[model samples]
Target chain A: MNHRVLLLALLLLALPSWAVIETYQFDTDLQRQRYNAFIEELRCPKCQNQNLSGSDSAISQDLRRQLHAMIMAGKSDIEITQYMVDRYGDFILYRPRFNAATAVLWLLPVGLLLGGLAIWALMASRRTRRVPIQPLDDHDRAALDSLLSDEEKPSERSGGNS
Target chain B: MSRIKLFLPLIIFLVLVAIFFGVQRRVQTGDYSPTALPSALLNKPFPEFSLPTLQGESLSRAELPKQWLLVNVWATWCPTCHYEHPFLVELAERGVPILGVDYKDRREPALKWLAEKGDPYFATVFDEQGTLGLDLGVTGAPETYLVDAEGIVRFRYQGALDQKVWDEQFAPMLSSLEEASP
Candidate 1:
C-alpha cells in the first residue's frame, strides 16, 4: 500500500507538466469570425476568380494571416482591406470601393436606372403626342370601297360575261 | 420643312452619341481591375492537416522540408485542375516538389487520373473531408500555395497555371527560394 502511494505521487508530479495552455491572439470567437468575414469579402487579386478568404493559394493564406494579425493589432476591416487595396489595386475587393477609379462601377446601375427612366418618359411623351394619320375623304373612300367590291365580283361576273 | 428636317439627322446623331458615351462609361466601371493580388497569408503559419497518400499512408506537415514548396489543392472533378496538370507535371520534372492535397475526391478517380496522366507530386495528401481545405482557406479546387519549409506560406496562385505565369512569376520565385535555402 505504501509503494502504491509513492507511485501515485510520482504520477501526480508528472501530470502538471502534461497540461499546457496555448493562447491565441484571437481570443474571442467574434473577432475570429469578423476576420474570416473580411477575408471572405475580399477578392484574391492574384487569382482574379477567387475571393481572398476562400482561396487556399499561398498568397491568400498569407493575406488571411496578415489580416488576422492586423486584427490583433487593432486594425478595422476597412483599414485592412484598404491596406490591401493600396498595395494591390481595386481588384482586391470582391465589392470594390467607390472612388475616382471605381466610381463608374458603383454608379453604373444607378445610371442605367436613370437612363431607363428617361427613356420611358421620352417614349410616354412621344406616344401621347403622336401625329395622327388623317382618314380618307369621301371620294377616296368610295373609290377604295368600289375597288374592293370589284375584286370580290370575279366569280359572279364570269357567268354574266359568258 | 427643309430647314427643320435638315437638323433631324443631327438630333439623332447627338442621341446616338449620348448612348455611346453612356455605354463606354458603363464598360469602364464593369471592367475588373487587372492587377494581381499578393498572397494574403504571407508570413502566416500554415494550417495543420494529416493527409494519406493513395497508397494509404498518412503524411504530416513535418515531412515537408524548410524551403519554398508549392502545395496544390485539387480534385479530379475540377475541370481547371486538369488544365493545370501538365504544367505541374513539367514543374515536377524540373525538381520542384509539388505537395498535392487531393481535396474531397474519391480514392479511385484520383488514382485513375494520376495513373492516366503523369504524376506530378513529390508527395500527396488525401483530404477527403476537406477540413484541411477550409483551414487552408480553400474555396475551390485547382488552387496553389507557395510555402516556405518553415511551413509559412510565401505566395499563392489561384486558378490554373499557364506558361506565361510559370515563366514570369513562379520560376523567379522558385529560383530565389532555392538560393535562399540550405
Candidate 2:
C-alpha cells in the first residue's frame, strides 16, 4: 500500500511540467526559400559577427522563425526588412539599405574608386614624364659590335694554330 | 627618340605599381560586411556527442531539459575566448544556461579558468581531442550554438560577442521567445 502511494506521487509530479513545443510548417516552397534567404542575409545582432542564417545563437534562430512566419503570412521582402530595420535599426541588414543616414555606406566605395582612378591617372602621367632615358647611339652600336667580335678573337687564334 | 623608347617599359612598370596601391587603399577604406553561410541548417537537430567533464563527470546534449541553450565551444589557448568570457558570465546570470565545451585544454587549467573567472555554465564538457568540436562544424575556438527546446540547432555564432550585438540582434529575438514560451 505504501509503494503504490509513492508511485502515484511520482506520476503526478511528472505530468504538469512537460514542455509544449510549437511546430510551424511552411505551406509554399517560394515563401520558404525567401524566408531562408532573408534570414541568412540578416546579421545576428547578439553574436554581431554572424548572420541569422549562419549563427546557431538562440536569437538568430528566433529571428529566423519570426522571419519565416512573416513570409508565410505574405509580408514582402521590403516590408520584412523594413520591419526589422524599424525595430533593430539598419545595422541588421548585411547589405545595409541606402538612405540619407547610410548614403556614406553606399556611396563611399564608389567615391573612393573614382578618386583612386583620378589619382592613378595623375601619377601615371607624372611617371611618364620623369623616367630616365637610354639611347642606342652610333657609339653604343660600335661598342656592341667590337664586344661581339672580341669573343671571336680567342677562337680565331685557335683556328690559326690548327 | 630611342631613349624615349627605352623608358616606355619603365614608365609602364611605375604605372602598374601606382594602380596596385590605389586599389589597395580603396579596399581598406570600404565597409567590412559579415559573410555568413546559408540557412540550410536552421531548425535542424543538434549534433550528438557525449564526453566527460573536466571533473570526470559525463555531459551531453541529453543532460539538459529542452529549452533555448547557448553551447559555447572554447579553449584556454584561444585568445578571443578571454574577450568573450565576461559576456558569457552575464548571460549565465540572466538565466540563460550556457554549456561550455573546453576544447583542447588540459583538465587542470580548464577547471582553474572557470573557478577564477566564475563558472558560466550549468555544466562543462571536455573535448580534448577536438573530435566533437569538428562534428559541430567548429572552425576555431569561441564558437557558440543556440539550441531550441526541441533540441534543434537554431543558430550559430563563429566569433566573439559584444554589447552592440547583444542589444541589436540578440535581445529583440529573445523577447519573442520569452513571450512564446511563457
Using DockQ as the measure, which candidate wins? 1
Write down the TM-score for model 2: 0.44
Give RMSD to native, each candidate: 19.6, 21.0
lDDT of 1 by residue, B1-182 (tens): 87988999999999999998887786566332234344446567777667788769988887777667889999999999988999899888889888999987899999999999989988778888765765665656788888887888877776787677677667787778778885
Give DockQ: model 1.
Answer: 0.04
Q: Worst ten-residue run, lDDT, model 2 chain A?
A: A16-25
Q: For candidate 2, what is the interface RMSD? A: 12.5
Kindly report which residue stretches of model 1 are placed more than 4 angstroms away from their true locations once superposed.
A1-162, B1-38
lDDT of 1: 0.76
Tell me the deviation in Å of residue B37 in model 2: 3.8
List DockQ, one per candidate, in order.
0.04, 0.02
lDDT of 2 by residue, B1-182 (tens): 87998999999999999998887775564322243332223567776788998889987767777788888998988899999999899888889888888986788988899999989898888988765664564546777877777777767666686665567556776676668777
